[model samples]
Target: MATMQSLAFSSPISSHRPHQQRSHTGLISSPWVICQSTHSSFNGQSLQLPQPRRVLLRGSSKLTGAITMMVKPVIQFIQGTDEQTVPDVRLTKSRDGTNGMAIFSFDEPSVFDSTGELGEITGFYMIDEEGVLSSVDVNAKFVNGKPARIEAKYIMRTPRDWDRFMRFMERYSDANGLQFVKK
Candidate 1:
């Protein structure tokens, strides 16, 4: 979700060294300037040094790009014969975006009371780009013998699975009127 542009300094500084070289003791010189040796600590000891080389200075480059990501969208859960969109749901994922948990909270106690009669929630489904995507291993939180919140965990174990998840998210976002935003 990012585009990068690279910019580098391209100019070369002139060395300006004389054709006839003059030798000095323990003197250091750069391409830009020459200075007299101030250190006399090397008492009468001659030092051999390498030839002066040209060095190019470069400017620090930045990414110069903007990264955008889609905010998690509200999801619709289908229970029994009823389908409803729950806005109080949250989708949290790992840093790699592979493993995640979807939590759906229901404020209406009647829905939980009615669904509890069956002893277990069955036919757990979600509306995806296609018709229905079955959700598995859904755990529920019960308060006073009535369900309050439900959590569904998902994992994408591979790149292909991640791609499929992205595709589903793309369509789901379109269906839910969601947009990607820069963080």
Candidate 2:
């Protein structure tokens, strides 16, 4: 099994020397360019590329076949007395040590609405912003059979909870013959 630490996010192409000129086909034409020329151009310091960080319920798992599920940014909406309000908050998941416990963190408080009412969350939807839905629409395609029981607190907060949610999603996708493709 490949550990998550081994996965690195490498650039599609390596950085070229600043002095190197590009040809018509966008290929570097210089052969004697200084290797550190590009590094010096950026305030005389070489910028290191960011490494891929370990995210909960992400990356390819040999134990779970070759299918890799991506974790995208999601916004949670709360059901109010008469309307739904989108909070200025988002959901994020990270591994808690090597125990496989999914740790969910947020910048803002996890309160549902301004009234401080609990258990008012109706459903989970993939959204880019408050009112704007995600382009993929995972819910519309991946919801079938008996409705999955979703609690406000167990919204991708722990590994067990996340796994349950994922199983529901995978079941729907499998039944509908839909494959999740990474973009």
Model 1: worst 10 consecutive residues (lDDT sum): 7-16
Tens-place lDDT digits, model 2, residues 1-183: 313211111222232111222222211222122233324221233434233333344357423212222232233434322222111112233435122221112222233223245454444443211122212211211136532222222234445443443443333233223243321
Q: List the residue pairs that clash in candidate 2.
A: none
- Whole-model lDDT per candidate: 0.40, 0.29
Q: Best-fitting candidate, measured by TM-score?
A: 1
Encode model 1's per-residue lDDT on 32-61: one tens digit a residue.
533245222212223332344444554684
Q: What is the Cα-based lDDT of residue 63 in candidate 2? A: 32
As a TM-score, model 1 comes out at 0.39
TM-score of each: 0.39, 0.21
TM-score of 2: 0.21
